[model samples]
Target chain A: MTTPTTGLPPEPAGRRSWLRDHSELGVCVMLLVLGALVLTDALTMDVDLTQRGPVGPRTVPVVVGAGLLVVAVLLAVDVVRGGRGRAETGEDVDLSEPADWRTVLLLTGVFLGSAVLIEPLGFPVSGALLFWGAAFALGSRRFDRDPLIAATVSLVAHTVFDNLLGVPLPGGPLMGVL
Target chain B: MNALTSLLDGFGTALTPINLLWAAIGVLLGTAIGVLPGIGPAMAVALLLPVTYGLEPIGAFIMFAGIYYGAMFGGSTTSILLNTPGESAAVVAAMEGNPMAKSGRGAQALAAAAIGHFAGGMVGTVLLVALAPAVAGLAVDIGAPDYFAIMVLAFIAVTSVLGSSRIRGLASLLIGLTIGLVGLDRMTGQQRLTFGSLQLADGIDVVIVAVGLFAIGEALWVAAHLRRGPPEPIPVGLPWLSRGDVRRTWKSWARGPFIGFPFGAIPAGGAEIPTFLSYVTEKRLSRHQEEWGKGAIEGVAGPESAASASAAGTLVTMLTLGLPTTAVAAVMLAAFQQYGIQPGPLLFEREPDLVWGLIASLFVGMVLLLALNLPLAPVWAKLLRIPRPYLYAGILFFASIGAYAVGGEVIDLVILLIIGLIGFGMRRYGLPVLPAIVAVILGPAAEQQLRRALQISDGSVSGLVGTPFSVTVYAVIVLLLAWPLLKKAVTRRRAEH
Candidate 1:
């Protein structure tokens, strides 16, 4: 599909970086790694001597592992043949613009930070931080209003989910207050 | 008559004040969340699924019935007012309804949609009441091998029929299958992919996967490409149809469920095709043929009914066969699992009240939706104007709470983040998320069925295709997988001629 131009040199502006052009190869790589992991795990599993069925635990995993490997190879071939996966589009999505990695990374950091802090800080504090940080990450800049709203949202969620709903959430330092 | 008696009893349970309150709350919350610009019915349900976890099973399911209908109505509301479809099913709604909204006929469009929804849902539920029992009875005779074959057929259908790239879809399925394999083998105590972690032994919660993939993944995806500036929701008064509007749309509403339910009842039959079918049928049969592209009310009426009808159809498949053909149905199936209820042939016999009550509430929900939403169309439209930051932040916030609250473990949060990243990657690469979700929910069951079939045949491979039903299902699977290649060859042959 990429027929070379013999007379004129390839235009740099028209060309994308190889990684960007073949970003789907990353999915292929991930699939391959997953396939290998599944296969290794299945092959190493200990089967009891008194197994009743020929279709033991390893059978499905082996088939699924092989399927993953086969699909990874097929996807790679399709990618090399100039077939491209379509980026998902939605109402808010502007695919014409490149993905904003900064927001995604910031949100990821906030999520992980909350996960780490939830046990120590309790949901009210950590959940508020999560909501506020996520809002900030998504470009909400009102420090006063955002924190207040975040706290309200967090407290309500904590109260409803923990106090009312009976999902046990660690209260951290606020263990005795409420 | 027997079905009627069962349905009456179901109403007895669903009509209680407590259950009715849950239904009302589900409808309100489902519509509120679903009215958000980017959230679809599936995501709305997934995000709210945790809330119902603490409730008793019957009340929760009644709530689910309301949420299901409410989210769908909300999706159409968004499609009409903002021309922003939350899911593929609503794309047809946006087609004629958005144009209607643009022309200052937004109220009529909403009226047509709401009424159409009520009509379609009523017909679909009636048919479900009539047919689901018979289907479940027939399903009782299906052997393990046949069941496995059907699962295989489902996998093939979702991967091949729904997505543009079959390979990508298959890859997504494999990813889900791998995730499904994380827990200990049910028969043996051996772990398949637990990696020695205690949390992994229980396997990743379907709620975590669903919320991560649909809610968090979507939030992150939208955040990365947040449409700057607020969405201009079309201003509208109460949704009210004229006599002529009703006369024109009533037949289309009748026609839509007949078209939608059968498609939804079949394995791998989704709402998308039926919606398009209804729109085209309405166009071909309409007196106002030229008005189709120019915002004809029939276009809104037919497809909205069809989408609603298909939702009912999806429930039929889910309840009778334990097969979920759409993302929302899959999540609902997961909800059943969360309640330790396996929705299959035995479900009708095992949980009559739960099943009948859920079915009964569908009828009740339709009435409630029409009554509540028709007067509140303008209010629902206002929900579209919420700031993108706060809207998406709330999604992540609730998503965190839901995931964490599932097992109440910090590890679930970590797993949620990982799944969320994978989901982000999936959207970036254009892989369909539905197939992965369906695979995750059904993969373990499929494996168990295959093993059971094989065990019965004493390790013989022929055991997989031992039954007539299994044979037929395998044949369909072959045809489905080969369909694209066959199409390519036929086109090439035509060119040669």
Candidate 2:
């Protein structure tokens, strides 16, 4: 990705440089779009006018939508005015770094997979898989100990949450046996 | 005498085997979550909210209270050992604690923190028992205008105090206030920002927003910035505090609760501000100037105590006013509402047993926390050894499961992902997330009160300032807003000299 320079000078100490860039501009545009979407829905909302004394249903939305517009403008103004707040203190992580990308993708995969598999595999088995997979993603290659630890954690959590705390997590295929 | 006797009765209810067990569970969970990096007590309580659904109301309250203080203790442990604070309140602890660890005095720092925590927790609990009813009595007399004024003050205070920059904080808060307006209007049944999504018609769950922002967002942020370096091995030594160390810390422990409790009782009052204030105070008052940043024992003692004390203090307002001073308190308040037991002025008159039993259990929970944290500091430290990948993966899995378990709605999972992305972006952009979370929780309540005040006065703006109490509250808000500018001016003049 090309770094689109907005010609704004870099931030001073203790401030983030990204805020000086065009990122927030994109966010503001998104907010405006969201506001339009919300306002459209709010206009079509069925409001009862008979029971209320003063304030009605559309009052808060209209107010909120208008407020969002005002803030979006202010944020735009701040960006243009080069209003720098605090400088970023820590070393910036390289977004393009392959190692970093691997970790990100691995974690995302684990989350997505767990969401899909949790009901079928049960929390105990799926949770263990999730935990072990994540550990592997984060560079823990202790293959011998990882599975045992993951299973232990999953079983303990299942026992506490399902048995003691009474959360009705699916016991999966092992429901009757367990 | 009557008050004393009533407290004894309260204690009687609290010490019951069932209540005691719940309290123990709450503290244990609180401390465990607190110890974990990136998870605070708020997320802990929110995550556990589903589990508490079937619990007896009293047991639920007991467990919630335990988790509250337990997180405070656990947070300090991470600050001391890893320099990764679980919450903002522990940031000050990290200053001295990390230094202490580097110097091989980690045990002493941990010991001091535990003791300070115990002292602060006890003092705050005592205040809660003695002062809550009186506060509740006073609160009953307050009208919408006064409530509105107080919330305004809270909004300003929290935004200005919690973040590195006020503009970003306010922006975050505004975003929250906007989110708060999404559900059906209390006065008019009209949906404000639902956008034809039926699941959103009921409004976004505070739990979903909270869990998404704090838990899921944090997990993502950590994954992106995952450190590849080997863990710093903490040196082992005697875990006992020296007599001199104890003597030095005692004064700070005693003073910390006084500083922390009042802040905790106020709206927007959470552990962050008081703990920061406590750390600055200890630094300013210390005779050992060289020890200020070089593993000063006082640094660990004061902030830890203040954080724990504030936890206790927050419970007082939560129980009495039906106002949540922090995210964890809000979840607990929601839990109480689930049980159909409103925690406000009438609570004492209506459910004295539940109120007092909960209060007494705080004392017991504090003792248990101290016992567990003091000797088992190393055990808690070992939790940090879990690989970042596995840890975050587990968190993400649990967060999704917790979201699904809440309503069994796929929509909630979608909201979680959206909010998680938003949270990740917020962190990436350097915006503070706490104020946003706080605003989301309080925004609806604040707006409703404002609208009601306006209605009462026939849409007159002056209606908000009608009563003497309301006037006083607004006056305080004005002063609070102005005080920052005044302080800045005074400091500039001094610098010029």
Candidate 3:
């Protein structure tokens, strides 16, 4: 999908080529779909006719929905008008690198794990696990050191918040033991 | 004289061992975050907001102030070392400082930036001390319509002037406004966009949105297009700026504050414009044109100074007018509200110590920042060598911790992830983040004022435009909107020759 290089002077396009070539069409379609969904939601919203005065519950949504639709239309128009910058039309940056995926997956896992474990594991252990897991995800191969770092981060954070600051953090299963 | 005595009294309050410790901790944390690429003071403040909930109000504020200025100082470190600017204001510094680093003058660039930051920060603090009370006096006269007008002006300036395209900027801002509307309608207590979910009732925390968009979203975007390349270590040299280099940069450093402060005071626009303006002005004024874009010391000094100065200027407005000119300022305002102290004209009369002590601490912060940045340039540069995977992972970990800690709500974590996804998408599509941030912070306030104005005028549209002050404010907004097109046209006309 790469455009042939013309003899024309290169434009000051930085990262726009990604949008110009591969993503603009998809982005345009997505915008239209999002706009349509929002518009539909906004339309179906029950207008509180009972409220007196100029603005009701539906007023702001209708305005915002219409605005979104208008912007979506404008964006589609810009794509059609060939105003897509060079960054959009250029070759996509490679995403196959392990470092990138590892980071992303690690973060995703950390968030997911934090959600699952926060109640059972408690704030201190869960927070430490989350922290250490994330650090590991960022490619920290220091197996021996990771746990220490994580535990320390979680423990110190707990002490500061729970003990010193007096904010109640969950004690988890260790409620009585700790 | 009375003010000076009161300020002295504030120093007495701020200089306490507890307050001093908090300030130091805040600066240390602020510097660490600021040195990281892509993170800035706004995110730093947001991340720390939950943690600060337990501290006494004065100590919390002292630490917050330290973070604000400390982040500014730290932002310059990244801009000078790597081309990756931690804050929008430091973007200009990166343009020249990166080149300097590449040319093996990394140490000189660091020295110039640190010194420039100190000078600009000092000037901004002095201005804050002198002008805040007067500005607060004027703020007392502002009615709802006036507040509405000012917010409108801020929205227009930020969304229209920021980023490469006005359309995209406005779009980003609209998204933020929409997000801001997710919670209950404050006026009527009616559900706006909760979609029947109880978790969405209180609305998404601004911190969740910020962390998601900035920290998580940024990490995701970076990861998705990771280049498998060996990290380049920036070579370090002598930390001190030579006599000749200092002589050249001194003028730019002096000029930078004036360039930065006015822009900072102007609501909505970020530090980017002023720093860019300062760089251009320095280039035009300089005798050594050949040095520019090729590691010019003035290039490093001017923009760095302007960034810090503008940061100070933003603080003035936040404290006095309760108006946030930038994202960082907006977050700071949120922090103030969290402390149960609403900043405005009444703030001076009500909480003189908090306001003045905060102002006095800026001067103290500049000294601490300089000492840390100047002698420790190499140490800061070592931060860049941190493996990307590890760095980003650390950010995510802390982000979740911060988000969860904010209210201890499990739903906040969900909000963080969703916002992070939005942020990632925006960055992937080249949509600017700051406009959305500024809009989110100002959106509810703007809507509140607009509704109040409408209510006051008995729902007359013209009543919204009735006051002279409102008219003036709208006029300024219109002028700002039209200026870019006018400038572009003028530039094109010149090129036609």
Candidate 4:
């Protein structure tokens, strides 16, 4: 991605260089947008004449939003001056390897799918499917044993939650037993 | 004498057959979960919080006390048996503990670690019993201005002490404060930032934030970096120490709690600092100088005791001042909120029986951890062999349940998913997750106190620094903010020279 000076004329390049160096400019932009939003929201609140005080609900929001803008500016300058936090390196795994994007994308799908299906399908059915789908996402191929375990886990969770703990879980088709 | 009588009565509550059974189960499960490859005690506590949702507060807290200490005891076992430490504090343990394991002294290392935990937990709990009431008394005298000042202090400490850069930490905190603003304004019943959405009018739930940040976020991050295969597990047996080993560890255990307690009692205290400090203390003071870097039994013993003692010390501020210094404490604060209980000075006056009972149970839970972990060390180590696919999938399943069970809204699941993805990005970018969660829980509280202080002074700006206590606190905050910049400049000058 670096070493890309080939495609452009290089006269007024300091501006581009500053932006490029400040890669965390995106976070700065986000902060400014959020600050604007908070200001917008705080200004739009209905004026309650009956409730007058030294401070009101809007005071803290305004202070925090303005603080964020100042922090964003400082952070951007720091980035341009070559300050950056290092990536996490754990003792357990090989961080040298690029992240397995395939597995990550699949797990994202599984979580999203479960969120959509959970209410309609109920806890037991959605829970089992979530279990099985996540296992697949993480590279499990034991089709026979995985399904059986997922079923047992989901059903047992249903029983323990609904019956034992007294926190009611949705029972779906097996509502009678669960 | 009154405190003693109440504590004894607390024992009567904790010693009941049903509560004892729950304590046993809590410690046992705490160890099992804590032994997972990457999961720490904080993550374990956060994940398992929902299980006690339906129980009465007394029994639920009895179980939580066990889970809290049990998980800490269990963290060291994983460090000794596995290359990766589950908790940051246990990283020091793995230094000496793993070597001891490889050298066929795994049993000895486990014994030292377990016994160290017992000593630390006992002493720490004793101090808690004595100091908590005194601290609560002091806290009662503090007014709204002081309370707001301390909350601001906590906010600064939490953000500045965590993550790589202060700016990122502040950013995460701002995001949390924005989220906190979504609900109806408590005083005037005015909606702040709900954007006409009724679901948001109640504000975001802390449980969803916790589950997303710790459980689902961690699971997804691990999956994204899924290792080619499972880590090779080190086999071990029941923990037992040699005579000489026992003699070696006794002094270290005695010293560890003294070093650990004050650190954990401070706001924004982290478990990692105390453990590392313990390791260095032992290294400097050890008789066996040859074993400094290798498998020094003192290394395992000192850090483990400090780690446990600090865990107990964290509870002091949490229960008395309603300030949480660690990630697990923040989540536990959310748990108290779930029960409609606010832990502060009034907590002692309003619910003495419950408070005493919870403290008494910590002692019981410590004993239970020692009894269960020594014989079951081998059994818990075997849990490390569970396939990654099934393990993480199961985590997601449980995390989803935790979110859905809270108010039973599908929209909560959507919040969890979005927050989980953001958590993933936070992890990837080295933006710590703890600050965000802490800010979310404490943001509303700080604002409430701020307004109360202001109302008392009729909107005078100087009202915030009204009391000498608040003045001192603000001075400390200014010092804290300035120290980092001054240090940076000193280093730069030194480098130039």
Question: Which DockQ values do the candidates obtain, in the order shown?
Answer: 0.64, 0.31, 0.29, 0.48
Q: Candidate 3, residues B379-448: lDDT per residue as tens digits?
A: 7767767666566666776777768777888878888888887777776665677778877777887778
Flag regions of model 3 displaced more than 4 Å. Answer: A1-22, A25-52, A84-106, A174-176, B1-5, B95-105, B227-230, B235-238, B488-497
lDDT of 1 by residue, B379-412 (tens): 8988888878888888898999889889789999
TM-scores of chain A in all candidate models: 0.89, 0.71, 0.71, 0.75
The second chain of candidate 1 has a TM-score of 0.98
From the highest DockQ down, the ranking of the candidates is 1, 4, 2, 3
Which segments of model 2 are wrong by more than 4 Å?
A1-20, A46-51, A83-102, A117-159, A174-178, B267-269, B484-497
Instruction: Judging by DockQ, tell me the better candidate of 2 and 4.
Output: 4
lDDT of 2 by residue, B339-394 (tens): 66867777887898788777877888889888877777777777767555566666
**Relative to the unseen true structure, what is the C-alpha lDDT of residue B470 in candidate 2, on a scale of 0 to 100?**
78
Q: What is the interface RMSD of each candidate, in Å?
A: 2.3, 4.9, 5.1, 3.4
CA shift of B38, model 4, Å: 2.5
Model 2, A8: alpha-carbon shift in Å?
6.7
lDDT of 2 at A135: 76
Residues A1-178 of candidate 4: C-alpha lDDT, one tens digit per residue: 0112333433575777656545567777777888888888888777567355867878888887887788778766765556664444443445668778898888888877877886677788888998999999888999989988998899889888878887767776656454
Which parts of model 1 are misplaced by more than 4 Å? Answer: A1-16, A48-50
Candidate 2's fnat?
0.31
Show model 4 residue runs off by greater than 4 Å: A1-25, A48-51, A89-93, A176-178, B486-497
DockQ of 1: 0.64
Q: CA lDDT, every prediction?
A: 0.87, 0.74, 0.75, 0.82
TM, every model? 0.97, 0.88, 0.89, 0.94
Q: Give each candidate's fraction of reference contacts reproduced.
A: 0.81, 0.31, 0.27, 0.65
Ranked candidates (lDDT, high to low): 1, 4, 3, 2
